[model samples]
Target: MEVLVNNKLYAVQQGITIAALLQFIQLSAHKGIAVAVNNQVVPKTAWDQQQVEPADNITIIRATQGG
Candidate 1:
């Protein structure tokens, strides 16, 4: 299956969870990170239960601190 992550195309396993996608892309699951699926913000507590579907528009963002 394929999904768009941050406007980029990514091929992932079928029924890939949000948590798994983060791991597949080598991103650490920590603070300052946020994920939204199809314009809906998914809570961190539900990442493991959120399953990504084909053609799903996923946006992964990180909070940066700067003066």
Candidate 2:
């Protein structure tokens, strides 16, 4: 299946969860991060339960240490 991630198209295996997607992208879950699917914010608790679909738009934001 293909999904739009941060405005870029990516091909991923079916039945992958948000948590897995993060891992696949080599993002650390320990860091504070935010995720939005189809323009709706998805809570961290739902990452494991949320399933990504083809053509789905996913946005991920992380807190940066800078002033």
lDDT tens per residue, model 2, 1-67: 9999899888999999999999988885647799999999998999999999988999998888888
Q: Give model 1's clash tally.
A: 0
Clashes of each: 0, 0
- Model 2 residue 44 CA deviation (Å) reads 0.2
- In model 1, where do residues sit more than 4 Å from their true spots? none
Backbone collision tally, model 2: 0
Please give the RMSD to the true structure for each candidate, in Å.
Answer: 0.8, 1.0
The alpha-carbon lDDT assigned to residue 10 of candidate 1 equals 97
| Residue 14 in candidate 2, Cα distance off native in Å | 0.8
Estimated TM-score for each candidate: 0.94, 0.92
lDDT of 1 at 49: 92
Q: Give the lDDT of residue 28 in candidate 1.
A: 64
